[model samples]
Target: MLGTLHAWQAVERGHDVVQLEREPEARGASVRNFGLVWVGGRAPGVELRTALRARRLWERIGERVPALGFRANGSLTVARTEAELAVAAEAAEAAEAGTERGYRLLDAAETKKLNPALQGDFRGALWCERDAAVEPRTAQPALREELAKTGRYAWRPGREVCHLTGTGVVDDRGERHDGDLVLFCTGAWTGGLVRELAGEPPVRKVRLQMAQTEPLAEKLTTSVADGDSFRYYPAYRGEALDALEKSQPQTETARAHRMQLLLVQRLDGSLTIGDTHEYDEPFAFDVTEDPYDHLESVAGALLGHPLPRIRRRWAGVYAQTTDPGRIVHRARVAGNAWLVTGPGGRGMTCAPAIAEDTAEELDL
Candidate 1:
């Protein structure tokens, strides 16, 4: 996504851009995510602003590329406990006090009214009308196709960059693609070329497991989230959240695995759900059923019905900066070569803004 955004921005500026992909297509964290352009959970200031800008960029880009499947469906973080409800209320107040986050604390009735698919017991929900989604499975291909039409963009796939040339990079194919500048948006594969140029980057890899269910009988009008999300997002921090944390802590397994329930309905009516965060290296190659079971139970309780049969299950890994303060680890690898990565789960949410920042900094 970063590479695509950079290329798009460069092309828009009347500059020729070449995007080289290690795989035939992007098959990394960019595609493995829930495709959520989540805005409500971002940190209160700079992060939130970046997210909002990216949200608008996504909508604009989606308009140009219909196949992106962008939807301004909004989101609801359902609270099932009193503590959770307090946190939601506080978040609503915070949203009102801050920027136009479009946050509203919805009662249980209102929550159900907005999303009829949610039929279970819940105190209320935090409604963020600015939240949206895109079809990650097709977003890149769609964007690349649109960029190609500009006549200034070129995509070279199946080229694993192995060495950095003074001007550009040399791929494993032993071909050197020359360009005035080079940006490495390598998602999770941070070794080899990246390490050689950047030197033991201050980034850590994170692993997660996710699954998708068969098409549902009814529509989930908006994306859905469980109270567990409050613990994971920074925006929910405050007196109320602190109180909730002290009164009602996460379950043992959830805390151990860093679990959160982020559910979004696909354009095909199927529900995409996940996920558990694993920060430690030597990540288990095998996907465990425990996290999936927990997610299923939580989602089922909120929906007031059993989830449709899960159609697919998988695990993925992405790089995250060890320094939480930095959104991404953007550094000049060489005089004209740059490496921009480590947006973590925010990759899909803030790719455009990140690339924009990169472009501005490099005067691209």
Candidate 2:
């Protein structure tokens, strides 16, 4: 997604572009995520600002590419306990809550009124109206189709860049593709050329497990999140959260996997849900049923019924900068080449803005 968005930005700037893809199709976290344009959980400062700008960019780009499936349906982070509700209140009461984050604290009744699909128990919810969604699985093809209409975009899939030239890059085919500038938007693939050029960056790979369910019969009016999300997002960090943590401990399974439930409905009526964080390297080669079982239990309790049969299950790895403050690890690898990676989960939410910044920085 980062690479595709960078291509989109370059093409928009009237520069002819040739995008080389390692795989015939993207099969990374870019396609495997929840497809959330999640603005609610971002940390304050640069991260939040980048998310806001990307939201605007997504909205504008969605207008031109309907297949992106962008929607402003917003999200509801359900509070199942009084402790969770207190945390929600704190976030909603923050000074920038209304203007910047579009936060609202809603009672159980109001929460159901907004998203009737959440028919189960909950005290109240934290509503973030700035949050949105898009069709992650198809976004790249849609964007590329639009870029192709400009007659300046060339997409070459199944091509791995083997070497970087001062002018451009050399593909595995030994074909020298020359250009004025080269931007390497490598995701989690940090070995080979990446290591040769910029040895061991200040970024680490994070693995996660996720799944999608069969088509839901009823409309999921908005995206959804479990109160456990409060424990994960930086936005909810406060004394209230501390109390909640002390009072309501996570289940052993959840704590072991570092789990959180983020549910988004796909255009096909299927619900996309996930996920569990795995930070240590050499992540499990297989998925575990314990985390999925926990997720299903919570989701069932929230909806007052069982979730649809899970039709798909998978795991993905994304690069996250070790620095808590930086959005990504972008640096000059050569006189005319740059390496941009490690936006973490923020890649989808902040790609457009990130690419725009790179364009401006390199004067592309």
Candidate 3:
């Protein structure tokens, strides 16, 4: 998405773009994500501002490409316990809740009224009207098709750039693509050329487990999140959250896997649910069942019934910058080349704005 968005930005600026992909198609964290334009959970300042801009850009781009499946359906983070409710209340009461994030504190009745499919026991929820969703699986192709209409974009798949030349990059096929500037938007695959160009950039890779279930009989009006999500996002950090954490510690399974329940209903009606974060390196080669079991139990509790049988399961790794102060690790690798990567989970949510920023910095 980062790379594609950069191409979008460049093409929008009347610059011709040639995008090279080593794989036949995208099969990375960019696709293996919740496709959430999540605005409510971003930290204040640059991160929040970037997300808000990306949200607007996504809506506009979606308008141009209908297949992106962009929908401003919003999201509800359900609070099951009183402590959790207190945390939600605190966030809803924040000064920027309404003005910036469109946050509303909804009681259990209001919550159920908004999303009837959440027919489970929960005290209340924090509603963020600014949140949105898109179809990650098809977003790139749809965007590429739209870009191609301009006759300024070229997508070369199944080609790997093996060397960086003064003009541009040389592919594995010994074909040298000449250009004035180069942007390496490598996601988690940071070895090889990235290391040779710039030695480590204070970034780490994160592994997560996620799954998709068979289509549900009913509609999930909006994206949903469990109260445990409070602990994962920066916007929820407060005294109330501190108390909630102390009072209602995560279950052993959740704590072990750093799990959180974020459920987004796909356009096809299937629920895409995840995920457990693993920060340690040398990640396991196989996905574990315990995390799936935990996800099923939590999802069932929220739905008031068992989730549709899980149709598929997979794990993905994404690069995250170790530096908390920066959104991504962007550095000039060479005079004509720059490496922008490590947006972590925010890649899908903020790619458009990030790419826009890159274009501005480079005066594209």
Candidate 4:
């Protein structure tokens, strides 16, 4: 989200910006996401602060780009088992103590008070009042439309860049685009783009699959995740926090075989739920409908009650790093050539603020 936002910001600031993509049409990972501009995780920490920045940026953009369905409904994380509740208690205490990302622990009565959709037993829930979500299908197009209006940018969606030479970029078509700067937002395909540039960092192409259930007529606006959700990433379990306290970077790979499921409800009354990750490293990126069943099965478990009906299913990919922090980097390759990428999965949440900051970065 940040890199794309930055690319557009660069365009707004009088720099000629050209965005390149590989698909004959622009669709996948970037658009096929929960559209969640969330700030509910590990409260008051760097992650929360960054999410808050992105969350606020979305708010600012929503002022004009109304299509960007940015909703500040907050986030609710439920604890099903006693062990999970204990962990939730720790997180809530940390949040209350002012960890930087403010997460409050609400008891079961309080949890159900706000969201009656919660059906199962839970000791308490983690409430992040600042988290928000946006439907990317609408938001991304609005952004592109706004970028188009700037007139300083050209969105070469069908063309994929083969490499870059100083201010010139060579596309797969054998054509080239030279400008004052070039930014990469290719998501999972960034490793190939990285090889074309200098200083190759460790990269993995991660595939995440998601689905939407039939609208329940009455919808819950907030997002939800559980113990199974905690296992999907180490940070939700506080291991990330503990590791960071010891000068260690917490890194986690979503166990593909475990069928970890996390669920969130969208504004249109449909249930947006998903995702198990498969890491196809060093020359692999695949999205298949076969994995849809895996995700649906987990969603069924996490929801505790039967999902009304599944209306759509799709697979998307993003770049993943050993250090779970987003893969966002901007460095000079040769002379004044600049390169930026590695958003991993949180791009949508972080992009708007990132773009604002990128817009402010003066050309040296």
Instruction: List TM-score per model, in order.
Output: 0.98, 0.99, 0.99, 0.82
- Stretches off by above 4 angstroms in model 2 are none
Each prediction's RMSD to truth: 1.1, 0.6, 0.7, 4.9
Q: Could you give candidate 4's per-residue lDDT for residues 127-240 as a string of tens digits?
A: 767777888666766777777887776767677777677767899889889876665555655556666665565555676667888876545756777655544444465753
Q: For candidate 1, write residues 72-160 as lDDT tens digits.
A: 99999999999999999999997343357899999999999999999999999999999999999999999999999988889999989
In candidate 1, list every pair of residues with a backbone clash.
none
Which ranges of candidate 4 are over 4 A from the true structure? 1-3, 42-45, 95-99, 163-166, 170-176, 191-193, 233-259, 280-304, 323-327, 357-364
- Candidate 2 lDDT, 1-364, residue by residue in tens: 9999999999999999999999999999999998899999988889999999999999999999999999999999999999999999999998788898999999999999999989998899999999999999999999999999999999999999998887899999999888998988989998999899999989999999999999988799889999899999998999999999999999999999999999999999999999999999778899999999999999988898999999999999999999998899999988888899999989999999999999998888
Please list the C-alpha lDDT of all candidates, in the order they appear.
Answer: 0.91, 0.94, 0.94, 0.65
Best by lDDT: 3
Task: Estimate the TM-score for candidate 1.
Answer: 0.98
For candidate 1, the lDDT comes to 0.91
Better of 3 and 4 by lDDT: 3
What does the lDDT read for residue 169 in candidate 3?
100
